[model samples]
Target: MLRTTEQKRKYIQATRSQNYQASLKLEGITTTAQTTQQSKAEILQKYKKYSQPES
Candidate 1:
């Protein structure tokens, strides 16, 4: 019973470390991805001088 408990603890720690590493890598990727995706309000502001006709 003690051995199993220890194994479970190690397994959890290993998985948590792996997840943390993956998240660290993804943080960089997400930051760049987010910058590339422009919001509608920002797009409008960029061309604010030219107004779009009503639909």
Candidate 2:
């Protein structure tokens, strides 16, 4: 079956994302909801220093 260029691009992008996710799972680096939240908080905390208003 012939796919349009857009269709082919979408399929390739989806496949690449799926493969990247699968690889992350294989490497035991998948982020759960809790871990995701924690990472977000940690990131915010880490970068908070630069957000201070000038005195």
Top candidate when judged by lDDT against the true structure: 2
lDDT of each: 0.70, 0.76
RMSD per model, one decimal: 12.1, 7.0
Q: Residue 6: error of model 1 in Å? A: 0.3
lDDT, candidate 1, 1-55, per-residue tens: 4369889899888789677767978786332323255899988887884785667
Question: Which sections of candidate 1 miss by over 4 Å?
Answer: 1-3, 29-55
Q: Could you tell me every candidate's TM-score relative to the true structure? A: 0.45, 0.54
Q: How many Å off is the CA of 29 in candidate 1?
A: 8.0
Best TM-score among the predictions, by candidate number? 2
Clashing pairs in 2: none
Worst 10 residues of 1 by lDDT: 28-37
Estimate, for each residue in 1-55, the C-alpha lDDT of model 2 and write its tens digit. 5379998898898789778778889999965533233677788887897798879
